[model samples]
Target: MKKTISFITENFNKSSPDLVGGFQGFQRAINMEKEDIIQEIVLSGLKGRGGAKYPTGKKLMQSAEHHDKEKYIICNADEGEPGTFKDRELLLHDPYGVFEGMLIAAFAINASHGILYLREEYKYMIDDLKNALNHMRSLNLLGDRILKTELSFDISIFLGAGAYICGEETSLIESMEGKPGRPRIKPPYTLEKGLFSKPTLVNNVATFSTISAIIRNGYEEFIKYGTVESPGTKLISLCGNVNKPGAYEVPFGMTIREIIYDIGEGIRNGNSFKFAQIGGVSGPLVLPKHIDTPFSYEDLNEIGVPMGSGAIIVVDSDNDILDYLDAVQAFFKHESCGKCTPCREGNRQLLNILSRLREGKYSQEDTINIEKIAKTMKYASFCGLGQSAPAALLSAIEHCPQEIFKRRD
Candidate 1:
């Protein structure tokens, strides 16, 4: 049984009164030269937790290279992934930790303003977040010249309208600009021309919180936790068929078996584990044979799966794989922004195929079409939404062909 790691959740038990005010990381960040701060983060090997797993230090260095006087930091709190709620827990329990991270980033990149782009589903948390901001302001942890340093930064919360596509950085930026939530074409990536066409640094809630931990504990201590290729801990939103379904923070090298059987207390009802979906709905399926695979970016990548959104949804043997595919396909179909042809049409066709398979009317042609469209979306889709929408379907077709397709007479 793997023990729960406590880097990020170390202060989960502390109340807001105890958690708020006096951010040592932010204090230390303000005093250091911006270049040194970026170097420290680069050395820490902290990657973005918003599914892409991009190097946080590299992104920060790029943003720093751009000498735009009006740089901005956007903390992506829009936890739109179906099974991922780790960000919500962070915002709910340790909001100040998030704020400190944003401040540290802002200072590192000379960003004057920060925006917390929160999802509408989490609207109930708006008031609490605002109050936390006010408290930070009162303590001089936020607003102009924070902690009496020359570095000045402020943060505001903008409510998202529950659109899944807005989880993409460009789409979120468009919505913030009062436009509809649709992804933009790349080459002016967020680091280049983001949020009002100014240089912006967009990072997820978990990424920011982890940044705070790295700063608080120093990069040396942070690197001691996880694997060489994937250092530090990840907060996983473990759900579905598991006895213990909740947010768990664990080191990167722990295997799926450890996470499921040990941390999650194994599959519910003693029914036996069928397969687990690591990451969110778009994440690829991990079969029983691969359950022992270490839960790290490099290892999962070796198996052609991504460490997306830190969501692990376990499935039991009793449930039909087609039914699960139906639900997942339906979500992607509904969430397709229709901005691009591949995603908008591909998801629709994918859902249609699932429906036919469920009714026992699907053909080998339908199966072929699923692969064709899934590959099309993976290669040609406009954004991450369209690109990753076919992950679960592809995994199913590859790993459980007997279960997903109908037998020919």
Candidate 2:
């Protein structure tokens, strides 16, 4: 049965058409009033695809309302989450969609400049991206007075220094300013003050691409797919112990079972399913029983999990929970920016506890201590890196307490 949908990947197998007659959506957007464009987006029910799930329309409206004339639009292409590579596919195949999305967002927000923060690991795609930008300029799809209109918006690519923390919007801005990529305190949020201390609008690659689609196809066409709460298709990165592991774009309402069995072709080598981690390493480990849960924000949030980065990693029965704990904890420990004491010391403490558990020396006090540190990091950390760092281990404890706290004999 054909289960995967093709919205973003529609042009994956073909070369992008020239923007001379294409980018009708971009043309449509510039012709419409900015407020109407934002209103249509709000009505479309499109939320941020970059894990935060914030309303895209609300974000645009906020930026548009700001009196700042030097607003900026940023496309966050730092695909840093473990096991998540959907953004790369978008930039690779649908580069035009990304560019058009940025242009639309720029026009709507009344911004003059834009930036695509490409990850350092994706240096290989730099030439192609530059070529695309140059091609757009030749067509007058970019640069001053695009399409002979009064709106003059331009986009440029900025390479990141290989910091996972830069995936966060403010931290990304800090890196663009030639500083260490650490998150800033909120209230003067990115929309109010961001890159170069100007009002900035930041969105992920999938998000910008979706914006172009929404405007091109019209919001009514977009609302036809997915659920009311999470209306629209999502590009999910499916990997780990699955038979057909790859990126699959599906609507928001599909159950995890359908994704793993029907879409992913079930567990590899006939092995029984153990659990699956929805989102990235920071997402929770969902047990086999909960596989029936729909892959939507409200559904997953009801179960205390997030649809982070849309990366689902399936696991087989052969793997032990402790192994995952050790691996994920190690990742957080290494990635911790040490900006906040709770995250820095908390990750180290969680790792220490995991080690003792592996050595069969864990006590009830160890479990209590792990919970203490995770809670602290979740609430007190300076940014999301620390807040979500304990998700995997905590979900492991929640779903398989026996395995996590069992004596390793």
Candidate 3:
């Protein structure tokens, strides 16, 4: 089998009927009742790629069913995870697909306005996206009375200052509304009350592009690639200690061992693989013992891991696990929004504890305290950032307790 099969990552550089007629189908889709589109999405089994892995169809149905006069559809281009860049790859090459996905979503949710919250770090790709948006508008795929239909939809671009926390859906919504990008409290989620108190559909860049592909290929063809629970290919930013460190789209249910040894071309510098952090910094570490676990949402969640951001960082026996964990802790510490005390204080405490442990200024009591804080943040925090911040750190410590406590000072 091929290492990377391009589905969502298909090249958009060429001309084709599907390419130009992107919104033409969307216009026809507008004629269908909102439930029709939502049901099709449910049938497709495409989950969000922004780490949450929630049912995209459920979100669309909720927002579509809401009786709101004003509704919104937002593309979260803010791929702010530390090693995540698959979204950047899409916005650069497949801008039309991204817009097309957003357009289809707007039709489903009856949204007149759409926004692409592009990440500030990926500002270099802005011109390409703007050009694509213009090309789309020229073809009547976006902006004002799309494809001779009464439905009028327009999209705008808003760049975001790079903040890892804002990658959370609610936090991204808050950032788009001119507030500091922080995760909002639940009970009124994004679909119910989002972006100026209106029904909204907020999905990341990869999710949007995948929607377009699923529409073009139909759900039957799309579902053939992945597991029943997580159908369709996933865009993974495969990096770290891998020999071939680049983005690749592979089907779900493939084992991590295959991804590392085969697709990744094995560990770099001829070193043996120690572990890999699936899904980004917040994802769980894939120990050598668990390397055979498949990359499916239900399977990983059953083992306390998540398909968060699809950013996998491979580590070898030669690398220091403690240092890697320390860096992970520091990232969460710096990126914490301070809206929730557990995330704000727990990350700081974790980082300090790790540093002090390395300096031989801490005891076993501090390790127990760290574990207690991690547990607190998971249940006590208001949002996902705080809840998941301790994951990789705790895992690394669990696997390498002596190394985590080794004196470096």
Query: Candidate 2, overall lDDT?
Result: 0.88
Whole-model Cα lDDT per candidate? 0.89, 0.88, 0.81
Against the true structure, what is each candidate's TM-score?
A: 0.97, 0.97, 0.94
| Residue pairs with backbone overlap in model 3 | none
Give the candidate number with the greatest lDDT. 1
Q: Whole-model lDDT, candidate 1? A: 0.89
Using TM-score as the measure, name the better of candidate 2 and candidate 3.
Answer: 2
Instruction: List model 3 lDDT by residue over 1-409, tens digit each.
Output: 3466777766555422245455444655677676777787889998888877788888887777776777888898878777788888787767777887888888777787898888788888878777777877777777677777666888888888889777787888888788998888786987888889887888988988888777766678889898888888998888998998888889998888888888989998899889888887887688898888898887788888888899888999998777788888898899899998899999999888888876777886897998899889988988888888888877776776777767544
TM-score of 2: 0.97
Query: Which regions in candidate 1 have their CA more than 4 angstroms from the true location?
Result: 13-21, 407-409
Candidate 2 structure quality by residue, lDDT tens digits, 175-265: 8998888888897999989989999999999999888888988998887888988888889999999999999899889999999989999
Ranking by lDDT: 1, 2, 3
Which residue pairs of candidate 1 clash? Answer: none
RMSD of each: 1.6, 1.5, 2.1
